[model samples]
Target: MRLAWPLVTGTAAMTGSVSVLLAGMAGTAPLAIGLGVALLGCVALLAQPFLGLATLAVFAHLDAVEKTLFGFLPVSAFKLLSGLTVLAILLNGPRLRRNIHDALREPVIVAGVCLVAIGFVSAIFAEDKAMALSSLQKLLSLLLLPFLVVVLADTPRRVALLICVLVATSVASALILGADFALGVQLFAQSDAATTARTVEGVSRSSGGSDYNPTTAASLMLVGVVVALSHAMETRQRRVLLLMAVAIGTGALILSFARSAALSFSVVALLIGWRHRHARFAVPVAGLVLLMMIAALPLIPAEYWQRLSSFFGGAADHTLGRRMTYNIIGLDLFTRNPLLGLGPGNFVHHFTDPEYRHLPGRTMLGRELHNMYLSVLVQYGLIGGAAYFAMLIAAMRHLGAVIRHPASEAMRVQAVALRFGLFAYLLVSLFLPNEYTKYSWLLPGIAAALHRCNRLAWEGA
Candidate 1:
């Protein structure tokens, strides 16, 4: 009876507060509603930090949705969620200190910090201070992602859950893209006309309602496919669901008409098959993938085939030729400033210089360097590039250790999955300048977390 009275009184107080908010801000109902939701989310996150982390993962993939829901406000939804999550973590002082200590010990984390430092240092010398500082701010914001994952995903189960959240969000994104294509709608399309109008041989490419362009979307889906494939191999309990995710993700990858994604997916598949050749599930999985490909082949649009074929057309292909031109330009920039290189985010500014005007395809001004490594080298020079490479290498080494550890099969399987996932990112990075991509940092963070979990398990045993 006492509990009932408290609940009634709490409900009355909440109703009164909400009524006041609505009555006071009748013209801004959406804002009021958003505020209410954010408040509730904050409370929930404080109560369960892991849930907040998972929510962040989901929003990371659904960036377009986040912008739609909260773009009006001065603050970003991601930043708000991150702030709340950090506050939640801070509430537990001992755990936060331990997490910070462990995170600092990670070589990948250290290398990442060094890379960021190099970026900031380069920014200080950048000719376009505003642009460089702006880019650096975004980069710094993204840097929090890895630390959050490392701290919150401390146990094997939590790591797995985070992985599942990633996979699930990827699957959801793929499904949304598929629906958009089938319905001939812009359900999740980028707002920019140039991106939406992209075409190959008279066929329009679908970006599908996300902030990501087709290529970026394909790369993100590829990560999901890799992780899902690994999970499929490790457990029978969710085999069907995982396979469905793989199939849907592959479809989305193909639908995006990204040649690099297709190539990377092929390479990762081959690597996984070779690694698990002797396993009992290997042949069946291979056979299923083969069947899926065969079934999907007839349904593929003709333009997609044309796009894929262009990947091998070399100098004859306009896009490939332009990419080659960009590479040369990037090299020229690197040579001109070989030591510290061009200041951060100054590549686009330099692209307009008269000296580069003689280059073929110089008409396409403001185009980013398509290649990630070249972008880093051109922006931060050899030192920063080395630090970036070191971070990736450290992540790969950590995952390799986890894979070889005497841990549970599931953990080992996830490690292998993440390693291949990172490999996919690296392969895609060859074509796309996604050096500062959240997913890139996220894979390493998860790798570090998994490595820590495996080590702790060993020590406990």
Candidate 2:
């Protein structure tokens, strides 16, 4: 078997080399180079499938940057990595089947399927079939990501490595945003106009790469902060690195200038502090935080303070009033359909109806509902919304199980961290329609993987 494997790999490499050579001779050097690199990556992923997961983790945060760098190429880096990961998993047929079987049994997985199915059914009944189908296709593609994580991250070591990769990418994203903010440039911005125009008190908001707006970027940093803080508490060896991650993430979150994200992060921080109130380091950490806040007060931009202050109420602040208008429109739409919805992705289509045009709010013809739960309820109606919430509840329950029955201290710590991170995500969702975001599913997938790993460890013990 080993001999056959080597022979196959060697033949494939030789074929790829010849192909690249021919392409290079044809005056397509870039294409040839890309082909060669892709071939090498495929071989590596096949040899060690976990590398595929790590690569995906990196691209997930930097996809916009990848797109900018590889604009000449027709392929998407994120999609390519996903395809490669799937192929790598498929290489081991037995393991793939076993993982699928186990993953299917998870409550989160089941509920996720139900939600997708409901979406599909809603799509069939949508007013704009083309738009609905397109939206559904995207949702289905993203929905597969969590299941893929569950299948690939089977071991505790693999889970830990994946978490580290996520954290590193998050920190890298923060640094990118910080540099952009400092230089007054949008280094890896998804949209120049949006980035430039989005300012508060003359301070522009910074975004993470790859379709992440300020709110989404801030939410991502918030998750990283919680995860890093928890890891710092769990292990002494990597405390410095983890603490640095927390600091950088917090900085990025503030730079985002996203009021809801900031609020959610504050709530999570307080919750964490309260949870560990009796711990030995609690007092010291509280004192350190107080000192840090005092030291940072002067350094913090006036714009940030102004923006946060607007969160309460200000004559110049129209964000809250705008969101309220959107909510009223969204509710009206819900009342119109009340069941399967106007159909998937039809909210914007129906927003400008003659009946709604007379409403008091500004003309937000194509804007989203700005709330995840409201979006789901308006688009998929009660059934799909129920399934979506059920999936999240199931994921939280699974994480809670892991926390209550951890095989190791590390496992317990991770469970707590993930639960808080998930809570932060949910809290942020109240202000943003993030139902289709990758992290929304990835968090739950990691929770499920942790639960399974802990269960397996108990069985072995």
- Which is the leading candidate under TM-score? 2
Writing each residue's lDDT as its tens digit, candidate 1 over 1-461 gives 32433444456458756864985568776667666665566556765677778877777777777777778779887888888788677765454677778987788778888878988888887888887887788777777888888888889999988788778877877887788778776676555631565645755666653577778777877887888887677667688988888888888887777888899999988887787899987788788778877888899988788777776672145767777888899999899877676777888888877888887887646778889999989998999889878888888999989877748888887887777778888899899878766787888888888998899899889
Worst 10 residues of 1 by lDDT: 1-10
RMSD of 1: 4.3
Deviating ranges (above 4 Å) for candidate 1: 1-34, 191-194, 314-317
Name the weakest run of 10 consecutive residues (lDDT summed) in model 2.
1-10
Which segments of model 2 are wrong by more than 4 Å?
1-12, 23-33, 192-197
Q: How does candidate 1 score on lDDT?
A: 0.78
In model 2, what are the clashing residue pairs, if there are any?
64-210
lDDT over C-alpha atoms for residue 440 of model 1: 75
